[model samples]
Target: MRSTFSSRLRRHALLGFLAIDMLGLVALVVDQVFSTDPVYPWIIAMGLVIAALPLLAQAVDYVLSTPADAAIVPDTGEKIP
Candidate 1:
């Protein structure tokens, strides 16, 4: 059970990393193509930051919601028998 949880966590982390990297690449391309003025770099930076916000929120929620032990907890606010 622990191994399965760890494997799932690793997969989630990898997916998050890929998502951030892809967002950065897309922002870079957009800045290079659309913005003609000197503000392009700042635009790219802002875009990346905005894209990362949701991932950051999810990570925080995961940390907060996970218990010290390995028991699965449902988010429905009801105790399971």
Candidate 2:
């Protein structure tokens, strides 16, 4: 993959995880404040699944990506080779 594309994917993945985390935190607050509501726990559980998608995608990308594709470090935007 191109360095710019790889970096974009990483950034989007991080954003996706951040969104799920924020939602989970909000759900936790709701669950605590409204103990009678049973939906919050389910929402929190769903958030867990949503959060795992990026990890799963990364795992697949790692397994299938070429060495050249991995040469570019997204964090530093540097090509190792």
Candidate 3:
């Protein structure tokens, strides 16, 4: 059971990474195509933020689901809310 849960978490993490990377790529393309000025920094920052959403979400989930006694553990063992 724990193995299955871990597997699911791994899969979700991979998907999240891909989703973030895609969003970053899209943002880069959009900025390059539409902006008149060199907006690479802004685009990169936006991309970073977009990419970070899933990670942030996961972190929040972990935090919320974690029991007080296991707060120090990297991953939450409880069911997500």
Q: What are the candidates' C-alpha RMSDs?
A: 7.8, 10.3, 9.0
Candidate 3, 1-81: lDDT as tens digits: 998798679767865666666666766677767774656646665767676777766764675453777655555566654
- For candidate 1, lDDT tens digit of each residue in 1-47? 99889867876676566566666776677767776665675567667
lDDT of every predicted structure (CA atoms) = 0.68, 0.67, 0.66
What pairs collide in candidate 2? none
lDDT winner among the candidates?
A: 1
If scored against the real structure, what TM-score would every candidate get?
Answer: 0.45, 0.45, 0.44
> Candidate 1's error at 43, in angstroms?
9.8
The full ranking of all candidates by lDDT, starting with the best, is 1, 2, 3
- How many clashes (backbone N, Cα, C below 3 Å) per candidate? 0, 0, 0
**Tens digit of per-residue lDDT, candidate 2, span 34-80:** 77567866576577757666775676567545577553545476555
Q: Pairing residues by index, what is the TM-score of model 1? A: 0.45
Worst 10 residues of 3 by lDDT: 72-81
Query: Model 3, which residues run further than 4 Å from truth?
Result: 36-81
